[model samples]
Target chain A: MTIKGVLFDLDDTLYDSTTFVDRARKEAIKMMIDAGLNATEEEAYNILQRIIKQKGSNYGHHFDDLVKAIEGQYNPKIVTMGIITYHNVKFALLRPYPDTIKTLIELKKMRLKLGVVTDGITVKQWEKLIRLGIADFFDEVVTSEEYGLGKPNIEFYRYALKKMNLKGEEVVYVGDRMDNDIIPASKVGMHTIRILRGKYKDMKGKCKYEVKSLREVVDIVKKLIEEGV
Target chain B: MTIKGVLFDLDDTLYDSTTFVDRARKEAIKMMIDAGLNATEEEAYNILQRIIKQKGSNYGHHFDDLVKAIEGQYNPKIVTMGIITYHNVKFALLRPYPDTIKTLIELKKMRLKLGVVTDGITVKQWEKLIRLGIADFFDEVVTSEEYGLGKPNIEFYRYALKKMNLKGEEVVYVGDRMDNDIIPASKVGMHTIRILRGKYKDMKGKCKYEVKSLREVVDIVKKLIEEGV
Candidate 1:
């Protein structure tokens, strides 16, 4: 079927989310040591990685836990230093991939509808869109908070399709996560292109279509349309 | 007294540091809420600012302190989520002002030796220079860590001058800070241009040259050469 719209994931799919955050965190850990956190940069970072693993990245207080683990007590001073430094460096480095906007523009020029199917708080995700200066490029944005569901939910993919007023077979879904974005949307009868990014950069996915950058999605769309895939 | 070099202060002077940071933090707070934190967006944000104030931005764990103050426990989930989300949004929004590169290019084309005199750890400051893609434009970058002296230390300014092999009268010091940068560099006989940015914006200074952007420094440099100001 010919594609009528291109649905996408926001974070790693649209940008180099992991690299910048990883750099910001590593920098913040260095600051924590300078501020008397009682651990080497490597030591602190390892601890942080463990904490993120156990509690999840969505958990709020990695540094606080890090200081207590290293210092054997709750120390606000060390924790605050780590966070503030983390903040300064993190926001200072945030930016989308160079080809992100160009890819969006290219998709729009083909008269294809562009929509975002992301798993985040509605307003927070919207803030990312606005701050990245890409909100105007999308014809639709469906977030987990608004849909009362999240990625991996087949109906959530369907919700985006419904919002775009296109059938699943006529839309192509692009995302970084195979389990979250690709699988569910594939099951929904939409074409799936897993855009390899961040941790998934080298992984061989089960999907028929995989791209290294958002820019490659353009060629895939053209092929899919010509071949009626 | 003709200008032979331009020395810069990093951060807001070379880029729009504050706005991106503020937006990143706000977006992070929204993520904190989605991760099951208490407090409205405004309330959480107000508390975050207060913690940043009391602990200073360099203190590593503002989010942890925030959770304890509001929830009365050292909760790691909310804090880690806050930090991660803060980090994601923060680095995603980090960028140099639109005119930063162009301004630096203009100064370089004039054959003026460009240098950076900034406070902070030497390597960290250098990382910023490298990431901003302006490190190559600078002939020298003297950080507080390298000089064993921080801002407001007149000797550090002198140190930069010594490295450049230019007399203070023949170089212009451009910084966002009146007290740390302009006053100290001016005392060493350099023509000082206060680049008003972030909190320094709109604040009147005693220096004869005040600029709202690095772009204006080019004109001032040309004017200083022609008039020997």
Candidate 2:
């Protein structure tokens, strides 16, 4: 029952993307409106949601596809407008939770294998990770963009396990989503931890293990390993 | 397939509690710091999450419990500080979505019965409905707090159907949770339409039928009523 590998979710879990994306949303909406499109801030969000349904969060690809989708009915100028606004938003606004760096440092010192399994746009996630300075802590990073699957998809979990060269039972997957992260990881035979600090903090009753802070995870894993469960 | 009654979720679908609660969180954390309990905003939030988990969101009853849980461990002064800040953060900010009132009006005009099935404290949710001015639209309202059961549990849905005096197949249940709303209702012979505007907007799957906006619900019900489905 010893955990030989650990998988972390990138967005909100590693880097606080809620604050990061709030700025991105505002800029993106202004660009859409200023470019003579009839879309409001709310409509831009609806468009983003539609894009996610179609493109699975690869912002590099989604950006162009969103413009084309809008251009199918509206003026094409909004595309450039959106691109410029997206670029002007600083990535430095992305902040890791206060304990994240210290916890990751402790996890690294423990010599456990580290992995990042996330549903995020390739360029955006990488940029944010690098900015947060914890990118180097991960031995393997699997993204929905690269792997062609998202969380709650068993195949994605399988792909991460394969890449890490670890059995499902040897890995502990931690994330903020109950259905997407905890349930599917547990279903795949990994010990799942629901982090009660991020977007899904208020969500209840879906994970095998729960922790309020990342620091607690190290102790929980040690206890589990000692108990052989 | 004529629709006899409609059921709705109370939290984010009919009332916008997400924004209100978010504002409350900001105020609560700031109060904790101002009361000298925490040095930074993140620490305050950490304490808040701890308090929420230990207390369980039980209609301000948990507020006292939250203070007791954190009392000797942290600063006792912060206990009294977060209460008024939590209340003033405005539960009333929750308003019916724009098409909500109009759609309910049209459904009322059609003479079909109406009801609500929600998962929350009844006092909190019913007050929400009344504040939002949609209380008059419901023939009967049921909450998990009243039954000690939450959805995906068919008993709660069954309770609502019995109160409305309608057979399962004679009513249409509209809600945003797929597993809870569409799946359970369909199992009990009720027609289900998955609303795409709220929590389930990002979810992918086939339900009985899917519609993007609340305005579309009126049309769906009208068609089924006309065809006598």
Candidate 3:
């Protein structure tokens, strides 16, 4: 069990994605209210929140739904206002947790190869890394969209291991979701670290390690490497 | 199935609780950052959000945990600042959805008994109704704490129906959580309407009806009453 590489999840693993999205969407709702949708700011906010809850956080037609719900039709002006406000607020606020950079640096210093294996569009995942200023820390970054495969697929984990020039048992995969990160990685004989955060925190899964923060991963990696794993 | 009374859940059923809590918690984190916490505002915000996610929304010692996570000790001043900011922001923003009052009024006009059967402390749930200005709309309000019981407990549904002088089959129970509202009511022979909102929206459960808005409940009640249920 000579651990060579440590992989991570992006959203909710290294950053405060829930807070960022909540703030961004709330600001977007305010912009919609100011644009004369004939509702109070809170009413507009609730409507948008409801639509997001129903559709999901990444749904592209949020503004379209917002306009229809508030004004009974799609007003491009209002939709544009909302989209601009949401993106502006979200991008401005996107940042890694305080311990993220320090922990990554510490892991890198331990001579363990670091990489990110995320499930998202290629550009969006790369943008997140660049925005957080941690793009250089990874030896490799694999996004399912770019790889033409998604997580829970053992092939994706195998691909990441191959890119790192390491065997499955020699790398540790860390992610927030059990189904996406832990189960498949474990299936491939890779030691899995389930970071207890994000949407799937409550989901049950199999993993060799479970930690509350990325900072905790440093200690676990150190122990495993010291013990020849 | 003739409906004599309609019952509803409080949080997220009558109001947008997810948005409400997110706004309040973020404001509280900001207050923590400003009040001599060593971390940046984003760091403080992330720490608090993580703790909330781990401990749950109703965990009583959130401020204690926030202070411990940021400052490494329990400082009453920081705790007080966080608590005051969180409560002020939450109380100021608490209000029902735009259609809540209108729908309640419409149901009243239909000459049907209306009530709220919720699981929470007595004063808190009552305060929400009062703050939303819909306290007078309900002929009866039952809190699990007041009744010495909680939801999914058949006794709770039985109590609300008994208070309204109605049989179980003559009442319709609407709630956001299927476990708390739909299943138990259904078990008691009450027609259940699961409002597709809140934390439990995606959960599977048995119910006689499902709706996206409180306003939709008015139509459901009208049809049921007209059909002589």
Question: Against the native chain B, what TM-score does each candidate's chain B reach?
Answer: 0.88, 0.86, 0.91
Error of 2 at B227 (Å): 2.4
**Ranking of all candidate structures by their TM-score, best first:** 1, 3, 2
Candidate 1 per-residue C-alpha lDDT over A124-161 given as tens digits, one digit per residue, 9 for 90 to 100:
56656765768778888888877899889998988999
In candidate 1, how many clashes are counted? 30
Q: Across all candidates, what is each one's fraction of true contacts kept?
A: 0.00, 0.00, 0.00
Candidate 2: Cα lDDT at A11:
79
- Give the CA lDDT, 0 to 100, for residue B33 in model 3: 73
TM-score per prediction, in order, is 0.51, 0.46, 0.48
Is candidate 1 or 2 superior in lDDT?
Answer: 1
lDDT tens readout by residue for model 2, B66-165: 4444554532234445554665566435578888899899989988898898887665566566557787698888888778997889998888889889
Question: Per-residue lDDT for B1-229 in model 1, tens only?
Answer: 5889999988788876778778888888897788677889999999999999998765777988888888888654456567767766756766777778999899989999999998876545655665566777888888786788888999999999998999999999888888888899999999999887887776656778887777898999999899975
Clashes of each: 30, 3, 3
Worst 10-residue stretch by lDDT in candidate 3 chain A? Answer: A74-83
- Root-mean-square deviation of every model: 14.8, 22.7, 21.1
Off by over 4 Å in 2: A1-229, B50-71, B74-77, B198-200
* Local lDDT at A222 for model 1: 90
> DockQ, per-model, please?
0.02, 0.01, 0.01
TM-score of chain B of 2: 0.86
